[model samples]
Target: MHMEILPFTIAVPDAIIDDLHTRLTNTRWPEAELVDDWSQGAPLAYVQEVCEYWANGYDWRTRETALNRFDQFTTEIDGLDLHFIHQRSPHANATPLLLSHGWPGSIVEFHKVIEPLTDPTRFGGDAADAFHVVAPSLPGYGFSAKPTETGWGIDRIAGAFATLMSRLGYDKYVAQGGDWGAGITTALGALDPTHCQAIHVTLAMGARPKLDKELTPEMHHALERLQFYRDWDSGYSKQQATRPQTVGYGLVDSPSAQAAWIIEKFWAWTDNDGHPEDVLDRDEMLDNIMLYWINGNGASSARLYWESFGKGTRHVVTIPSGFAVFPKEISPPIREWVADSYTDIVRWQRYDKGGHFAAFEVPEVFVAEIRSMFRRYRPGF
Candidate 1:
């Protein structure tokens, strides 16, 4: 089969923007949450305010222009049309790097670090540290083609990404991701070790360690946090995994539903005192929400969980791997625990700040981590 890599641009018609305004203006809002905190969900007032700003103040053209500043392209891989942003470095010998985003995140998450990673000298770093960056929107997310069948899980997604890298003429590359991106990256390391030189992941999903002895304070805390997530924080995952179509209706039809559904995760997973905006910009968060809204991927994106959540893709990764431990990550597995699954762990660093969305929350730190990890595995560091 022949695959064509076509240059792509983002140009939403005026009719779509006008329709969005009508929907936001005429939204039928619900009553405020009973509690003052966000324990229940996104506060009614908060959602209303954000939606109002989205309708009137947010400018998709500005976001579209900034996105188009980078070279974007689409290619068919494994019967799915994949969308990716490819930025080549000025340095001829720059290493190729494939960056992947997870659920509720789009290529928008990597916008902050793309230039710095691709042109390190401009960012006050050595030119040798530069990388030819390729960040792809996952299947059923953003501009990537939505899967119509039932087999588009993480394993298949990993295979598609490897095909994408090959299609782009990269024989070897490093992969980095967090959230669902982390899972797919790990899968890539396992499935395509010959081409995937190394991997850096913010979220390390390994087997649950079985300790014969007592647990340490840190281990206990990690377990408690994981349990809390399964109990309190995993409601959306369960809903999405079991009945995506049922929930996707609300998300696709009602922009407010989509915004609240995604914004709630940002608030829950980010390292923020009270609100998601404390660490993330309001417009940036809205831009991510708009990716889902405009693409009408509310249901398709959620179906990823349904496809592969418990299909047992969490196998051990043997390639040289680096794990960045963020302080406020939704699931912060201990280094000792992760070492069991990632046998060839080369680097492990714990940060005092940041959370699930490290690239978005701390681009400087994220870039530093990526460079430091690959430097260990890259030839002649």
Candidate 2:
């Protein structure tokens, strides 16, 4: 299929911003959570505080300009206009690298790491470690056109990305992701081993606990976290997977509702002591939230859960793969759990810090991990 890749720019009109302000000012807030902590949900006071700043102090223009610094474009792939940041390295032979983001995250999550990955010499890194980064906003998220039809699940999304890489003239590339991105990247590695050489993911989506295995302390802790997710942390997923449209009404209509829904996850998932702000500043978090708000992606993005949950396509990845085990991940997988699925595991590193939003929370460490893993596979290495 002939595809036309067009240059894209993000420009939210004044009217939309004004509408957002009006909504923020008029939000019908519920009473504060009865509990002192976020066990119930995003606190009323915190949501109000974030919404107030989002209206008054936050500058979308500045953030938009900063985002546009990276080369961006849109292309018709699988009947959708996919938006992506394609930052090429100054080095002549830098490897093409595809970065994927998951739910509650936009391309905003990679803003900090893009520069270092694309131009490593400038950031006090070896020229050999540079990458030509291609980070796409998934269908139904950010500026990318949402799917009006069903069946835009993980397998199809991975195929679309492979088409995207080919459209960009990249015959060989490496992939990295966490969360849904991890699942898609894994699929990419399995689907197109000819072009997609290797994959590095913080989350191994194909992994499952071995019920009969003797449990180590780490395994015990991981199972406990998994149970915790099933009991507490996964309510958002359940709701989105079942009734995305029902929730999208509130998310699209009220900026406060949208911010609270996403912000609470940041606090819960990141390696922060008390609040998400301990790791990521309000502006950084707000910038991510704005991508969802400006695009009115609440329902559209959430529908990805509905379309892919329970029913997913995860082919065993035979390509060389690497895994970064972040300590505070929702439930870090053991190599053995995924060994049957992700064969040829090349690099596995467990970090002392970082969490689900690895690139956003620890860009330096994330960059280092990518470099360390892919150095061997670089062309002519």
Candidate 2, residues 188-279: lDDT per residue as tens digits? 99999999999999987457898796898778877887889899999999999999999999999888989999999999899999899999
lDDT of 1 by residue, 143-219 (tens): 89899788999999999999989888888899999999999999999999999999989886555755767888767
Q: What is the lDDT of residue 310 in candidate 2?
A: 82
Collision count for each candidate, in order: 0, 0
RMSD to the hidden true structure, all candidates: 1.4, 1.0
Q: What is the lDDT of residue 335 in candidate 1?
A: 73
375 Cα displacement, candidate 1 (Å): 1.1
In candidate 1, clashing pairs total 0
TM-score of each: 0.97, 0.98
